[model samples]
Target: AKQIDDLTLAIIICLSRLFLHISADSKYYQSFFWIAMSLLQIHDTKLFASCVHFLDQIVHSMSDNGCFRGQGLATFCASARKGPSERMLAKLDQLSGLSFKYDFSFAVAGHLLKGLKNVGTKAAVTRLLNTFVEYSQENNPANVTGYFAAILPHCGDNLSESCRQRLLSCSETGSSVFNAGMVPDKIRASLLFTYLVTILKSSESEHEQLYIYKALEEGAHFMPDCLPVTFDVLMKKMEQILVASQNDQMLTAVLAIMNCVYTYGLESSSPVATLNKQYMESIGFASLGSADQFNQNQKGALIQAVCRVLDGFLQL
Candidate 1:
């Protein structure tokens, strides 16, 4: 005989409250919360629907207040381990629309795009990228730049390359539709630097090499200030790889550095070009017999390697 259980219903309600509490603070807990939420849906459809209703109310309330103050809501939405449903996405979109108009934080939108990426939605990522580009150009806000920077790493290789080129073009014009504040430029530069590093670290095919070369060239030409920092990071990684005689990794890193320098120097009047020359001169390669003979030889070798990389840039 099937028995009705009022106590079971009460227990389910209590569990839902507890799950929401934890999910609000720790992104890690949201995975378990979602799993529990899914199980509840399967066993008690009413409870599952109720949970969704609660989420909708929370989102609306946050939008209205112009403050998404619920830690649990943000954590749950940002959990990379969860697969958000159509209903969930609709709610997120609503929240994003509200955020765009009033909050301007775009925090919800960024999380929704991240959710789509975690679920491996290529189409969603493409749509997000396109929307970001449009918003950045139209609004020229710091939040827009941050959102794009956050999503850039999740995009597939081809899409990343396309977006990167757009960013480079924007930076070159100095008419960046985004803010020119140090924080915004730094975020954008960091994304480019990280992308280039990833390409150098993982690329093994000729096609990948070509794409990486293109990315490096664009980065060097657009963000000269980032070169020294990028070089430092790459050199450290290369040293680690060289210790193990990982010839492939070493070669890739070296080539990427050279390509970046040459392309950056391609414009004779560009700051990067001047910096490259200055770097060579600092190493005592600008004049013969200008320093200790041993120092001269070592500096000359460094300059030669740089020149080799620059050669590739000139052909572009």
Candidate 2:
């Protein structure tokens, strides 16, 4: 029975990857996201090793533009229940070098974020993020925004103070070119949102919180739904943003309120619950079929907003 279960799991991962490979549309790619999610659940080291080997094979065959897909695969691997072996880490290192040739830095950033639980691997990931941040700033490249955006989620006490200082500095000057005609609105929005989200999620120093509150107020003028769902802890944060005396800060506070309502104000369900269901199904989990409970229009609108933001980042 155990052998049979293992076989079934292997088959599912392979089939889901194949489906993902064939699907060009985001929706279809999302449909097979479950394969990666399922891979994350496996505990058997040997079986996990085999899965990473197969994904590495896929990475080798990718075109230069297609390399980002491999980075995405690496992110999935990092999200697995266990850490990688020395051999796998070496492979990740090799892939990281190749990832710079394409716009795969965001995918690499995702993997780095997931791998941060380990002291050694986390150091490697931090170095990689630092390199990307520096490269982006020095070269003033376009798509590096996506890569920097990915790193934002993992920024906190775990990151060095130097790294945090660099990120904060980027938030100020990074958007300058974006505000100029050089960058598109979508890319600008994505970069701004990424910086905002990172600031919000990071350590709650009063100075840092004040900076984020000011930035969010400025950002709310453009993308209104940028705030994450506000529960108890987040509600207090929102309140602090609201209490600021500046009119721009108040505008951001209002936007945060609106986002909380739109995100968590479901009559019978929560947005987080709905998003989780959608995410699980995309990764190929057995369907609970409860996602249909939300108004289709509402779900579509929320998804559209997110996609628009992502697309904007990609444009950068």
- All models: lDDT? 0.39, 0.39
The runs of at least 3 residues in candidate 1 whose Cα sits more than 4 Å from the true structure, single-residue gaps closed, are 1-119, 135-138, 141-187, 195-209, 231-256, 259-316
Clashes of 1: 2
Best by the TM-score measure: 2
- Candidate 1 C-alpha lDDT tens digits along 137-175: 322334444344434433434445545555555454432
Per-residue accuracy of model 2 over 1-316 as CA lDDT, tens digit each: 1222567557746764675356333432322322332232233333334434443333333322243343443333333312222233223223222121222343334333333433434444455555545433333334455444434434534545655655445455533223323223543453344434434544344544545555544454444443332222344556655676355745555566546456554323343635643433332221212111112333333333323333332332
TM-score of each: 0.31, 0.35
Q: Which pairs of residues clash in candidate 1, taking residues 3 or more apart in a chain or in different chains? A: 24-71, 24-72
Residue 1, candidate 2: Cα error in Å is 15
For model 1, state the Cα shift of residue 146 in Å: 5.2
User: Against the hidden true structure, what lDDT does model 2 obtain?
Assistant: 0.39
lDDT against true structure, model 1: 0.39
